[model samples]
Target: MILITGAAGNLGSAIINSLLKKVPANQLAAFVRSEQKAEQLKKLGLNIRIGDYNDIASLDNAMKGIEKVLLISGLSMERLKEHTNVVDAAKRAGVKQIVYTGVTMKDAAVSPLKVLMESHFQTENYIKASGIPYTFLRNTLYAEVIPFYIGDQALNTGIHYPAGAGRVPYVYRPDLADATAVVLTNKGHENKTYQLTGDQLYSFTDVAGMLSEVSGKHIAYTDVDPVAFEKHMKEIGVPEIGIMISTGFAAAIKQGDFEVVTADLEKLLGRKPTPVKQYLKAHYVG
Candidate 1:
């Protein structure tokens, strides 16, 4: 059976949904911390394995009889430790293969988002050292995050940010999930890494134009100074940490850190990845 950690989460659930189309529910096992959180998966006839990344015993118990594992990265201050716990548990369980979700920053040393991505780099190294056959899905920023970057009042106040003229190949999360499922069910992907990104590059200016066309509103993009952006976020009651995180990502974008694009996603799906304009139209149009 294939065990999927964080099975109830957005990306994990999407991957499960994609997996369901190709395999039976009996072939799938969902690892969740609480039974209550897994009610939907349970109703779907999946084997429910109770576990937490913080609890190695629970993880080990969950991995019992599991052949392959999808180690969905955790979001926490203790992310690296928790990920190591999962890796260690998988090691003890003798899992045949491990698939990990990672970010698509080609050069972590020069990327402004290095601090945020350090755990992923460390986890990748740890996984390699564990002697387990693995596949690393290095995913780019999701197109679903555009709404968050633009904010609720973007239609009126325009896309105000400090991303500058740099572009990103913002991929759709569902497409990434689909590719992950393909890797999980198929072979010849062992010890490989794939950069999951959109087929096209786009900047905030391009996003505003698409939104304007889709929503019939004159949306615009303003490349504000980083200091001014932080001040605005602070005045709007954004937490200090949130402001810092946003600024860091903006700096990375401004430096063209997310500009990489590849045909890996298209090759996996056997079709072109969804365009940013299509996504914008779906979410912005009535």
Candidate 2:
């Protein structure tokens, strides 16, 4: 049986939906924060287990009779500890394999993405040290989340960002989820790390063009100074952590941290992934 943690999350839900087409419902389980959070998955006749990565006992219970686990990365200072708890529980539960959703920062050893996502590196180390058969899905930035970073403020004030003309191969969350399901169901993935990225590379200017074309508005991109961007984030009442991530991520992009192209994603879906223009229209426009 395969179990997915953080089951209510977007990526987790997509993975579950994709797996349902191949794996039987009886063999699928969802580990969520609570029964209330899992009602929809339960309605689909999936086995639901209430567990938190912070709680080892809960994770142990959730992992019962589960052979493979998809440990979706967490989002906080406690991420590393949380992942370690899940790995330890899975080991005790006799899980045969673990599929980890990790990050892909180009030249991680010397990038701002590395500094911001230190937990991912630690978690990867812990999982490897645990001696469990593992598949690491080194996913790039999610294009679906571009809304959060780009913001509607960009529409009114034009696109103001610290990133220069560097490009990012942003992968769709659903596509990564679909790929994760395939890895979980198939064999020969143990100890493998797949660098998954979109087929196309787009810069912030490219994104501005996409928004302009789709919304029929004259949107523009301005390359702001990093200090000015940080000040702007503060002026907009962004929290300290949010401000750091925003500025650092933009800096990483400017330094060509995410400008990677790979055929692995196409191999995962057996088709060309959707284009940014199409995604922009479908998401931002009518």
Candidate 3:
């Protein structure tokens, strides 16, 4: 069976939905951290298994007889530790192939989000060392991150963020999910790392323009100091930790860190991924 952790999450649910079209329901496993969430997945006629990265015993049970596994990165700054737990559990469960979602530009030794990239690299190292065949989906910034980052403010007072004028190869999570499910179900992806991204690159200013055009509002991108940005985020009740992480990503973009879109994504999915403009319209407008 193909096991998917974080099954209740957006990307996980999308992956499951995409795989269902190509694979049988009995061949799918929804690995969740909570039994309550498992119940939600159960309604979809899936084999729900309770598992947590922290609980090795639960992970072992979740992976029983499962040949392929999708190891969605756990949320939080402590992603490295969380992934280590997953790697250990997968190894013990004797899973054959593991597909992990990592970040794009992770090979760069130094980046603004070193903490985040290092976490993926560390887990990638563990997966390789375990002697288990693995596929690393080195994904770019999620296009949907914009809505979460600025939607409330845009709805409130038309305020946005510290995105500056930098461009990002903002990928849609659903597209990434499609490619991820394909790799997990198909062969020849073993030991390969795919840098998944959208069809083109775009900037925060570009996003604001699209939103303005779509919503027929005068939304604008404002530039601010990093310190001021964090302060504003905290004042707006964004957690201190979350402020740091978000600001760090913005800083990375300002340095032209995540602007490259590779051919690996199209090669893997055997189709062109959606463009950022189309994604913005589909998700934000309609």
Candidate 4:
């Protein structure tokens, strides 16, 4: 059976949903931290394995009888160690392959998010050193987060941020999950890396235009200064860390960190991935 770590998370849940279409529920296992979180998976008839990435024994039990594992990266200060714990447990449990979800960056050394991406780099290296066959899905920014980036009052106040003219090939989350499922259930993907990105790149300016067209309201993008953006976020009650992360990503976009577009997602899904404009129309127009 294939085990998916962080199965209660959005991406993990989506992957489980996609995998159910390709394989029986009995063929998949959902790994969560608690019995309460496994309720939905239980209703789906999936084997719910309660485990924590930090707990090697729990992870070992979760990986029992599992042939392959999808190691969703964790979000924490101890993320690197947590990922290693999962890898170690998987190795001991004799998992044949490991699929990791990592971030997509053109160059890791110069990427503005290098510090944040370091854990992923270390996890990838750890997986490689573990001698387990692996597939790395280097996923780009999710299009689903555009709403958060633009904010609820974007249509009224126009698209105000510090992204400048940089473009991002934001792949839809479900598409990534679908491609991941394809890799999990298919062969010839072992020891390979796939950049899961949208087929087209879109700047905030382009997004503004799309929003205007979809909402029938004039919208514009303002490339504000980083300092001013931070101040505005602070005035709006955004936490210090939130401001830092937002500015960092804006800087990364301005530096063209996420401008890389690839057909890997399309090839895996056997069709073109969803476009940013289309996603805007569906979510904003309604």
Worst lDDT window (10 residues) for model 4?
Answer: 277-286
Model 2 lDDT tens row, 1-286: 9999888999999899999998888899999998799999999889999979888789989989999999999887778888999999999988999999988776777898676576777888898999999999989899886777788656666888889998889888888888898899999999998889998899989999989888778899989888988888899799999988887788889999888888887897898876867777878775
TM-score versus the correct structure, for each prediction: 0.97, 0.95, 0.91, 0.97
Pairs of colliding residues, candidate 2: none
- For model 4, the local distance difference test gives 0.91
Instruction: Summarize candidate 4's per-residue lDDT along 61-102 as a digit string, tens digits.
Output: 898999999999987868999999999998998999999999
Question: lDDT scores for all predictions?
Answer: 0.91, 0.87, 0.81, 0.91
Residue 159, candidate 4: C-alpha displacement in angstroms: 0.7
What does each candidate score in C-alpha RMSD? 1.1, 1.5, 2.1, 1.0
lDDT by residue (1-286, candidate 1, tens digit) is 9999999999999999999999999999999989898999999989999979988779989999999999999878688899999889999989999999998866777888787888898999999999999999999999988887778667778999999998999998899999999999999999999999998889999999998988888998999988998998999899987887889889989899888989999999999998888887877674
lDDT, model 3: 0.81
Clashes of each: 0, 0, 0, 0
Q: How high a TM-score does candidate 3 get?
A: 0.91
